[model samples]
Structures are given as C-alpha cells and as structure tokens.
Target: MTSPGMSITQLLPDGKLIVLCGRADDASAWQDLLGPARCLAIALDDAPHEARPRTLRGASDHLAWQHHAIGGLDGSGWLAEPADAFDPDHTATLVLPDPLDPPDAGNRRRFGFRRPAWRLFEDKTMVDTLWDAAGVPRAPSIVGDGTADLSVLGAIVDQGTGVVCSCQPRGAGPSAGGDGIWWWREGPPPTTIPTAGPGTWRVRLMPLLEGVPVRLHGLALTTRIIPFPPMELVTLPRPGQGTFLCAGAVPLLDDAADLVTHTERIGVGLRERLGYRGGFSVDGILTPSGFQPTDFNARLTSAMEAAPSDRRVLLHAVNLLAREGNEPDTGAVEQLAEDLFTIGTSCTIFGAATHADDRASRTTSVRWDGDRLVPAPSGAADGRLLITPSPRGWLLTATLATARLPGGGRVGPRAPEIFRVSDEVLGTNFGHLVPPFDTRPSACLPKVALNPEPATR
Candidate 1:
C-alpha cells in the first residue's frame, strides 16, 4: 500500500531539484497543486517507529531548516537516535530570520533587492506612515523628535483622553509584546522616563480607546496570504511588571468575519504594495462601532504561534492555492482539512510571561530540587539546553516536553516532568470539539503565565 504523501520538490538554480518536507502540510497539497513534473513524496505522518527521523534526514540530500512540528527533523537526546544531522543549518534554525543573502557565481547578491517588507512593521514609525498612506485607520499618534521633554506629553493627556506612550528601537523600561514601553492612563505622559533621556529616542503617543482588543496572526507571503482566526486579547493588570498578563480568543467575537476580511485586506496590501513575506500579525481594538488597527508587527507575533489546531488546513491550503497548478480539488481538500482540524490537534492551549525584551533573564528556573519546588534566584539559568526559534521561550519549552513523550511504544524523555500552568494566569481556548480536550475545562487552559512569564501561542 502507498504511504500517505508529504515531501515535494523545489527547483534550485543549479539546475537540480531538491526534495523538501518537514513542515505541517501533508504531501497531497503539493501533489494536488503541482500536478506531475517530478514527485518523490514521503508522507511523514505514516512513517514507522525508529524510521521517522531517519526518513526525514535521508531526504536531506540538500540542506534545509529543521521543522520540529513534524518531529524527528530535529535531533534526539536518545542513544542511536535517528534524527537530523544538521550542524550547518542549526544556527539559522535557532534564531530565525531569513538567512542573510548568499553571494552568487561572481560573488554578487542576486535576490537582495527582493527583501521582505520587515521595515514597515519592525520600525513602528514606518508602519504608521505606510498604514496611514494606505488609508487603514489606525490610532492617532504624536511623533516627536528625540528630545528629553516628557513635559510635552501633558498637552495630549490634559485633554482628558488617556494616551499610550512609546519610543523607537523599543523594549526598555515598560514595554510588552514588542520593545518599547507602553501604558494606558488618562493624564499627561508619566513624568518619569523609563530608560535613557531623549536625543536617542523617537517617541509616539496615542489616545487610549476603551474598546475590546484583539490580535490576528497570519502569513504575508509574496503574491498570497494565509489568514488565521481572530483572537480576543484580555489585558490583565500587572502593577509590578509594568506590562500586563496577556491572553485570549473565545466567546467568539460578535463580528469575526468582518475582522477577518479587514485583516486579510491589510495583509494583502502588505504583500502586494510593499513586498512583504513571512509571518506577521495585526493588533487592534474591536470597538462597539468597528475594529481599529493599533499595532502591525511585520514579524510573527505570539498569537500566530498560538494558532488553533484546526487552522492548519487553512494555512496549507493557501500555499497550495497560491502556486500555479491544476485547480485544487477544493471539496476533497476541505473535507480532509476539516477532519484534520478537528481531530489532529497536538495541543490545546499556550502561555507566556510577555515582556518587550530580555528573554534570557525571564526563563530562569531553579524551581525544582527533585521533589521540592523552589524559586531559583533571579537570573539562574540551569536546564537541559533547549532552544526555540520563537520569542515565547516558555511555551516552546512546554510544547517540546509534551511532544517528546513516548508515543506508540517509542522511547520518550528520561525525566518525564513538564511544568504545569499556574492558576493566576488567564488562558484562551482552542479546538471546536466538545467535552474538553483531556477533561480539562476551557479555563483549565492548557498553557500558562507567571508574573512576567507563562504560556503563549
């Protein structure tokens, strides 16, 4: 019998075609999308025990990034472990950003000119100009020339409307989500400067709107878009951390469809107009009147990483539809996608102790001395060396713990103790199936948040 299909071909400039797989998508999408020029499919989901990682690395005739979602593509701690031998590509896989441009035959860069529109997102000030020019209504802001006058914030605040404050190259003294401190208050900007005084700082201030905040994560690939469901954000106050305990996305938004449409249009604009590619998210408030965009992160935001199990079909389908090929068998694909979405969920919830910057300081754990759980000294970093590409390190650690468990009679981790979520942190739910994922209530939320740390998407 033929195995369930997965790997597909990518034509290299060297006139050779390389086989690529290991992402979540099954091979059928490529087969349905690419038709038949050359097909050497290896459906990982159906591979035998002990043969999985070996199966993946065997196809590494050409080097590629490790995709942990499919498993085995990353190395194992097991003896005689059949996992990927990726010494060359491991560094790029850890701190993921697109790889730097490689020089060509005459040592000239060929695709450097075709860079993604990361500037429009990372450079928050630039995002303002680009979104404004595109006529997308975002929060109003007061941009300032790097001056040390926190006094000027008085004018915007004294008007009785609360204002949000931030500075360039963000991520110091009171920032969350992205770098740069932000706060909601009814008066003039806080008198105190969180970091260094101006001249080196470019600032932005906007009136705080009392609306329901939501975040949408999606892909912005060249010539296409892959939008995920809208997530409602509950901003919990954390007086000590400056940033709140952030989480959400259930009780279903009253008008989720409209939010999706608006978001996808914005995503499309980013792709077609400014030449964007890769993961991104848009943060906004869902006012009683309508949704308004607040922040646009060019790179992947935490919410995208927390994607619901069911959205996988939507994600893979978009990639297939974007390529040139025989028209996809949409009905067949959707039915399969639907089944996968409902039953194939590998996780239920995610968590995180979000801060705008400095992850190394936050994830330290001296908590467990065998049977005793004790807090480690601040900055105590001791544990097996586990690295995740995401900014949400805590969530990555939990997921790896759960996923590596012995499955179908395989050897799992030696020490089988993954951390559990704390009661204090609020969590959002995933999956449309009933009766709870593992008998845990939706509020028993599978992820976590601890002070400035917890589960994340």
Candidate 2:
C-alpha cells in the first residue's frame, strides 16, 4: 500500500528509471517532475530545436523505440542500440511506457502495465455492450459493415440532426484520434467511405446528439470510484470535410448531478467486470434532457491535467500504483478530487493540427476583442497563445486569464473563434469551422430520457 506523501520514485522498484514519452513536452514535464539525475527522459519524436536539457530522440513510434531503448534490439539498420548513459545490469532499470501505448511482455515483467484484455474497451463498436452491462443510458446505435448502406442504417437511429459514423479498427490497433469519425447530414451519403483497409471494415452509427460536448473523468480505486467535474471537449466541425477536430478541453460551465452518477456507474462496471484500475473518461453530449454517453476511454485522459499543479504528478503516480495491483491511499485520492472542485479554476488547453514540419516555438499575447481574439501588447493580454511544431504537426495552445468568457458559459462555443484567430495570426490553416448546435426537442425528434433523473441546473 502507498501513502499520500510518497514520491513517485519510492513507489517504483529500486533502479534507474527510464521514461519513454510520445511527445517532447511530456518528456520535459517528467524530467522536471523527477529531475534529470534520477531518470533518463527520452522522446519518441525528434527533439524540438529549442527543447531544454537536450532530450534524446528515438524512433518515431512507441513500440519500436521502446524495444531499442531497453536493450531489446541491437544496433542494426536505422534502429540504434540502447543509449550508454545507464547500464541496465549494473543499475537495475525500470522503464515507464507511454500511457497511450500498451506495454509488451518484456516491459510488463519488469513493471506494472495495463492488461491487454482491458484495452478491448477502447473499441468504439464494442463499448455500447459495456454500457448496457453497466446500465448507463446511451444513444441508440447500430453496428454494421463499412460498405453497408449508411443512409439506410442512419435512418434507423437518425433523430433529425443526422447520424455519426465511426470506423472500427481493422486490425488489433486502436483508432487514431478523431480520424475515423464522420458526421453526415440527412442527405445522400458520400461515395468514398473511410475504411481501415481494403477488406471488410466495421462501422457504428448513431444519431448525432446535438448539445455541448462534455466528458466525465473517473478514478477506479480498489475500494471505491471517484468522479471529477465535467469538462468541455471543445470539438469543432468541418461540414464539407465530414469530420470534427478535437481541439482540446476546458472546465465545464456547470456541474450536473446526473453526470456524476453516470461516471460512478461506469467506473463500477469497469472495476467489477474488467478489473479496470487507474483513470478513465466517458465522452458524451450534455443535451437538454440529461447526459448521454457516446464513448469510453479506459486510460488516463487529458482531463486529469486540470487537477492542481502540485497534485498532478502525484495523481499520475497513484494511477500507476493502482495499475500495478497496489492499493493507493484512498483518502489522498479523494482529497485530490475535492481540491479540484474547490479550486474551480479552468485548465483550458486548445490545439489545432497544422500538418506542417516547421520546427519553431512562438507565443503571442492576445485579448478577446468582441468575438475574436486579437494580438495585445505584452503584459496587457487576457490570454497567451502558443504555437509549437510537434511530431504530428504544429500544436496551438491557449491559456486564458479566466475559465469562462465575460458573459459566462461553456468554452466549446468559442473554439471556432479561437481557431480563426490562430489561422489569421499564425497561419495554422484551420480554414473554417463551427461549434456544435444546442440539441432541443422537436416534433420530428422527441426528447430522450438518457438518465432516470432529470438534469439539475
């Protein structure tokens, strides 16, 4: 069992720690948290030109890079040998895999990693069954082949707004972020549908629930489950492109009792059925009636970053301990949740993929002038906008002075405007976008009672 004040190093086995990160910023954060002398931080992507302390760049992908990092592969072809900074035999080495990737057998033997069986929960087409098992309310959905007539399948679940089609993974891999999802209006479907490969692919279709996109995060402990406040998903739509951009996340406008209930139920189901541990998030739409879940991610998500700065690292450590079959101090985990609710300060992080290879970091002071964000003199801005080149593309992040706008509401509505400013000032090439429309009961589309209890204001 682990205590509240235990440092991350103490929880790990006595050895030299090696942290493999998918992004450079993650490596830098871990390095700062654990210090360079204690751990060797290696980034999978090429190190940014301005990265501090000079992190080593390994293979572009996680599995291959990790194999070489831990002496699994010898120097051959493009795959380089393990770094000589630390001797694995002389100093017992423990490698921390990237949270996003599933660990292989070699790493699992050395440290605690999430079980592969649990990763099946990430399949979009398979989650509806889990929701049914958990008794959580969800939108109606149908799973069929990709080549099937979408218009026919959509009509079954379409409630006027339209239907959302999600392509399931063709192989053992999980779907990429927001790439496999498409929203179609009430019209003729597209000729060329997205598929994992040439062979048969599975697709799940459901009515697009119109409303604010929000997610509830939960930590499933050994004894109980703790749910955090809802967060705005800030997903923007590109109509013609038939896809949505997952901008980032921020604190929600208000909290609902139903959301908490849904999260708790989902967490309990995960723990009892799948033996899930650590953090998980449920994505759904906050419609007029109640919370309607659409997706489930059985891993630590971006929402956990909104916790208090000091507790963020510790929260991650607690998750790792729980995954390792060790019980964490339940009181401390509950305290972290309470502190987050008490603080109520928004942790807004928005990003746009530029698809450019330029390696540079730029920060601009900006203020909301009417509806748009414009450049402001240094020290006289309401927020700071930052753009940096990443492995995937250029990343845009905004830190606002306040959680909500002056009028006060969810941050999702302002995502389009922020993307516009980024395109104008930084040339991010986001083109055009729009926020999700509020879902209301209509004659054509009746109200959906997603939860047993009505939503509380």
CA RMSD per model (angstroms): 14.6, 5.6
1-457: candidate 1 lDDT, tens digit per residue:
3211222113111221112232334344333433434322233333444433332211111111122322333333221122222222222111111111111111111211223345335455556787776557666677775635554663554334355566664331112343354554543344444655555677776655555556665655444455656665544333233333333322222335555566567777676666665546677655544556667765434442334423432334333322223223334333432333221213222334222233243233433454322334565322321223222322323232222223311111111222221211112111111111012111111111112222111
Instruction: Please list the residue runs of candidate 2 whose C-alpha ends up more than 4 Å from where it truly belongs after superposition.
Output: 1-8, 28-38, 46-85, 90-94, 103-110, 190-192, 195-199, 305-311, 337-346, 355-361, 377-379, 439-457
lDDT of 2 by residue, 253-345 (tens): 554555676677778778888888877888888776767888877776766444544455556666777788675567777776666543254
Among all candidates shown, the one with the greatest TM-score:
2
- Candidate 1, position 185, lDDT: 53
Best by lDDT: 2
The C-alpha lDDT values of all candidates are 0.38, 0.64
Clashes of 1: 21
